[model samples]
Target: TDKPAHARTSNLNEELGQVDTILSDKTGTLTCNSMEFIKCSVGGTAYGRGITEVERALARRKESTLPQKLGADYARLSGEKTFVKGFNFKDERIMDGNWVNEPRANVIQKFLQLLAICHTALPEIDEETGNISYEAESPDEAAFVIAAREFGFEFYERTQTSISLREFDPTSAKKVERSYQLLDVLEFNSTRKRMSVIVRDAKGKLLLLCKGADRLVNLNIMSAHAYNSDLFSLLPRHFISCPFSLEMKSAAIKAFKTSVAQQITDAKALLTSSSETPETLALIIDGKSLTYALEDDVKDLFLELAIGCASVICCRSSPKQKAQVTQMVKVKTGSTTLAVGDGANDVGMIQEADIGIGISGVEGMQAVMSSDIAIAQFRYLERLLLVHGHWCYRRISSMICYFFYKNIVFGFTLFFFEMYASFSGQAVYNDWFLSLYNVFFTSLPVIALGVFDQDVSSRYCLKFSLLYQEGVQNVLFSWVRIFGWVFNGLLSSVIIFFFCVGAMDHQAFRNSGEVVGLEILGATMYTCVVWVVNCQMALSISYFTYIQHLFIWGSIVLWYLFLMAYGAINPTISTTAFQVFIEACAPAPSFWMLTLLALGTSLLPYFVFASIQMRFFPMYHQMIQWIKADGQSNDPEYCQVVRQRSLRHTTVGYTARFEASKHFEEFSEIKSH
Candidate 1:
């Protein structure tokens, strides 16, 4: 509640702490989803060196020769440059219309034209500024349109059936108007990895322009060796319903497979020549291939290949496939799963996982509504899980155990008092006092502990991510630990009863032969129970702030005040009982001795056990494990390996893997945008 992150359900917070695997969406969730025209491939040549926006700004500053607060380096080239909207490059050969004179000028022009007319992005002009902007279904399409505009092929207008573009015609050395009559559009879907448009140009030539994720096309080649010409023939039969000629489609498929194979061969050669491990590369697959890989015949082989690969990119994947992958991981590894996304397409995956985090972004609210936790951005997940998640699990687990312990001690003490009265069912304490003990006397301190008590700071949580393993391994709320707490409660109850009975002048009270003697005994038992429960505040691992201290210690002060008032004013307590309570509670040698002895009896043994366990046998996670080990595994050398392996299977492992992927930078960019 004190932090920016909000949890709709308290129980879900514990699940976040236990997340071992995070299945995240690529766009909007991992990458900035807001596409920047960073690099491009045209005429088999890559252009626009992959540099970020900050690097471009630095490059611009370095090239400037103005006299300023910071001096420019003369070693860097200085020039008057014509800046493109999305393209930022310092190479003179590719800048300021210089690419128009290159040998592949026609190919560049055709590439820009293809980018302009290939999708369903609609252009809008600002009435006031007269500036044109595009509305696109996806960031990739929007980036293409923006790139086309920057390359001198401005998509100015579109109707139901035609697209108009104003272009700089290098052959004519002037700007020219061109219209493409759109014959048909093949829009992208999960099944169709690419989108294409059939448009008739001004010259009456109809051409198909297409773009898609290259990973989807290139990855299938790795498995081509598993089948022969018969399988290739079957692929064409599967696409028989398509309008294209069978021969044309078959030739295109064959060419594409051949090109992909060559690409893999070249890549492997480059890696080998440089003495790099090819295993570090990711395995890429599309939805179609993923489905095939999951078939019983190839499932084992697919799992081996997927797991051994350093990374995987499942391109053009459907929502159902995403959910299937999430389920597969959970069943196989027996690990907690977390899925995060920002769109309706992710709803299935989000609902399928143990913990789902939704980012409220450009996508609709469907994912957010379905998720366990809704966040404003993906990056906030790191803090929400590590800090708040850890605290919530620790607090609730401790609160539950303490709740049980407190009630058990109070109940057992009454049972012990019942023996003194010949197994009578009568309660030792007053009905009102017994009713208020849990609700009024003890509630606030535990509530405060649950809400505000934090064993570690937020900074430490982020630094030592392995601490999150506590929840995953069920270290706090296990059966063994719960029973250990129950044992402590029973021990405390026995100590309180025997100590109070031995210290009291029972014979003197019995000589009076009044019901007031029974009342006096009840008061002594009540005070002992209160003292023992309150002592838990001192033993808790959580750091107590000033308010927490006031909540705990102030409750003890209030209890004493209530006892004094109850003895004096309550009709149930006679004059003799009042005098006995006052004598026992007052500042005197016997009172002090009795009070100190009761407190020490109830608290000392438990405190000693806790200190020994934490200081010397910390690796013994549970009392049961320690007992079973017979003191043989107390040393770090005996248990460190198993503990480290357990730690690596938890949230710490996920965080380490995430950092290695460099996905954090993408999350930062999306948040900044």
Candidate 2:
């Protein structure tokens, strides 16, 4: 949890803000990445009395619906919070060597023995403590070894040709040390979807111990060697198809390539086929079926069916299949997609996504290395995307638009001045003013905007996550917004130029009674430009801090200080700017009056436009801030109310896609059971 989030790429901030669909791996990205053997079915009997998190959730949903029944359920679940890592089995039928009294004790022994003698986990023994720790390629394998040990089949040592275990013999009621001759290991790979280990027991009987995904782990294949062969035949298939399949003996399966293609044609024919309302149907595909479904001819159909369904499950899928699904979703919808993972198997999918987030967890560093962003925990994504991401998008957009506005304001005034002088090339500002305008006067304010400006607080950004839709909609940095800024700059330039020229035309200075020359005119105009642009910056900032205040106000003060200091120097060095501010401009009342007049006039249009937009047609974030100010943000139904009123909710969009696809494994774990 101490692992800090790292942004690997510069431009990914804006992309993170706009992610619409997230395709994530299950093992480590959404999980704790530490595996525990919670439940297992063997010999036609399910062991482990602990209820899964999914069952607790379903129970909570029922309690919430029927409050009168809540107390009874709450009392039943009270004070049952004991948790252990790697081993969570709690059935009294098997715990503390109680499996000896069971009807099929011999079968359980073989299962436990298989767990202890499995492939490819090295044992590290602490000589001082006499405790053994395992280092396996995966958490699942390690969990199996640990669970076996907890059940009194301790796998204490392993070598190239033998696996030694300390076991409790139920018949003798004593602990026995046993060694099995390891023959060969058929390692697990993506293609096989299972791993097997061959070992010769003390009686010289060859045994093949296997484990894998449900689709490939058929107990019937090993029933001939099982002590309780009749019990194995009576076991439940556990191949669940749908909600109502408990009464059905066999599910009517659909071939992936053919059914998907046909369904796409059928879906196109119906008027409401793509409607987003709950349809209660789920699409499930396996690795072998996905192979045919992923061909160019069937890919589009597969995507269409997958998207149209209420949910999708990809079971026994290979690494390539994960990447293919992510790529298909990204390409077909044309929406921004994010992939998250925490293992080497997920690297391809992570890299294929538009935004890749890797979790630094028990899985390893392969995903973290290839990711666009690295986070410590999955929950941190809430802050990453909602708060930091929104801030980044808004800051970049505002900085870019401000650059356009200031450049136009400064350059356009000079363009008008050149036109007013009949193309004589008489500059509107002094050489030093021109040289230092951007570098000194206007630089700090823009830097503050780019680095620290935020439209809303981080807490508020997270509180109202719907505010993120604005960035996804490209509300801040669009062509229309860019053109609007250009227009504002053009208007400011016009007001600053003409107002200065018209007010000072043939006007006399009160102190000296001398007509203002080109130098005096240029100096006054430069003062107006600085005031107008900096005032605009002050108005643009939504949340102001001391840094912004210093930059904005200090820049104006810096301008005046540089002018007086440079003017006080010798006339030869100061040249045209010599005493321009001190003797001519600063001493005259007209300069002050005209400067204030031009500044106010230049900023007047912007003020009106902003007021009108805020008052009449507010954006998503503006409305959210307004609600927060009105004290509605604390209400439980606040997000729902906001969603109902949002313009983005008019059509079913990427938000739904994200909910459906993102963490589907976690969802399936909750609902599929």
Candidate 3:
């Protein structure tokens, strides 16, 4: 708790306040979290279709009809990478492994099957609970493998270490590679933007097969197709003499058999959930024994695929990308960046952030275990920030408004009654009414109103110290407007009731009157009730433009019901006849009229609120623009003055911490300026 999530690394702390640039990962962080393996390139040929990082490959059979024919290598690449492999038709480039095409899975559907009967990643059964659970290395990889099983592909048992399909790599002996040794499988990271596999292929050649963002790839299929379109134009025509390039563009494709596994080897599952933790796969590939390397044409084709690609869509992304990007955002913004992810891959980023909130519902315990704050829902973000944390500030501010007005109005009434009662032998309601009214009806309603206040825009303004300005005046005005609408029609009943009670002295004799002080008392109690309810209603309504949310309506009814029950059974009901008369007043429609009057009075605040929305609410986006356009409109000077005071207060608690650190002098210097 002493250090921020991302501050575990010392270098990041030094770069604070200097974040003038921003860099982010395209997947999961900026974009929704999804990764698939689609598209592939063999020799120089590219294949597969679709935008997601996850895809299915069921079309490239050795016995299919297309631009070219499928050979053993192309079929093997398809089975492993989950992309359709092989060539079609009389076209030499397509069959000769001289060209690649990203064919849509639906391009040929009969062959597409997700056979689930026999598979490496099978559902595990529990005896006691009859529960089902299975394990997969990566969430995305698991999805494709499951999808293949679901469609119709049965798990063929022909594996000593690995598995492949028939008509592709027949004879398990021929299907296996000698030089390429499978190294450790590392998960993708949001920060790194890459996932690599180490392999030692034929002739003892070691190479790192990296598949991530297509932009990082070396070849594209579109470029080559466009390059040889005329060659493809002739039917039964084939271009068998295209060269492969080492430099490539857009590594959007992975080549293997058209099958998948839960995990490549028998290892304890580490990064199963979708997280931001830095996941890396370690593989060893030997290049010395390699016979076929991508030529220039193949490289150009990959580059074309990388450029102009809308979404990284479907590439096996690495775990490091997730963690790295979160750090990048913090560094670039020069501020704390909170990243909430629910995957094992999200761990590094979670540890690397100033604050890391993890969602723990489904992704699993690893993600939740690494998170600082775990929430049950995504919508709770607004609730956490707006309704709970900042509600305290809003409640205090609104209370200050209510307090100001109540004291002023009550003080005037008390002073007036003191003089009149001394002179005329009577006053309005006693001090008990003044104190009891707010405590009972006003307090709960107002507090209840506050309990429900939350908004998208309100939180932003409140965060920046823009809620109020210049202390007393700001406090004074918030209530002026609040009570102005609150008391416009209210003053009439108060004046009449004050006079009638003083003249006739209704409190002196109880049975002489029933509706004696009814107008004033009812208006006073319910006006305060409805106005605060309106404030609650208004606060609720202001956000969604509809005041009838279940919470708003329920809070209103719940508090009123509680008060009604209290009035029915309270000891005060039997204390005095005057009290009993007031309490015994039927649930009449009269005060409700007064409530309408109070609601009507609130119309005056509409324009003021509109001005706040148009002026105060949007002050951040165009604070300077509003000033240049008309600071007089929202009073930019007061805004700036309020801004300075509030900012200093927020940082005050951290002062000692800053003081103990070497950064204090620099912070103080900036503050002084």
Candidate number achieving the greatest TM-score relative to the actual structure: 2
Root-mean-square deviation of every model: 13.5, 9.6, 18.1
Order of models, best TM-score first: 2, 1, 3
- TM-score: model 1 vs. ground truth: 0.75
**Residue pairs with backbone overlap in model 1:** none
- Candidate with maximal lDDT: 2
lDDT of prediction 2: 0.73
**lDDT accuracy of residue 399 in candidate 2:** 93
Pairs with backbone N, CA or C atoms under 3 Å apart (clashes), candidate 2: none
Instruction: Report clashes for each candidate as comma-separated counts.
Output: 0, 0, 126
Worst 10 residues of 2 by lDDT: 226-235
Clashes of 2: 0
> What do the candidate models score in CA lDDT, each in turn?
0.63, 0.73, 0.36
Question: What tens-digit string does per-residue lDDT give for candidate 3 at 1-673?
Answer: 1112222223332122111111222223222333333333333445443221111111211233333333444455445443321111122222322222325322212122211212234455487996434455443444444333323332332223333322112233222322224454444554444455454434566544454444444553111110000111111100010000000000111111111211210011111122431221212111111111123335343322322221111123334544544454455434444555555666776677665555544445565677656654433433433224343444445555555444444444444545655756444443344455555534553554445443324534333323322121223235455775346324533443354334333432234445445334432443344344435334433233233354445454554554445444645551222333244333444444545554444444544665676655542323523433553435656656545433321111122233334476788889999
Error of 2 at 158 (Å): 0.5
Clash count in backbone of candidate 3 = 126
The reply for model 1, stretches above 4 Å from the true place, is 1-6, 52-86, 89-100, 215-286, 295-313, 331-334, 505-516, 569-592, 619-673
Residues 89-177, candidate 2, lDDT per residue (tens digit)? 65667878989998889888888887888658888899999988899988778888888888899888888899999998988878899
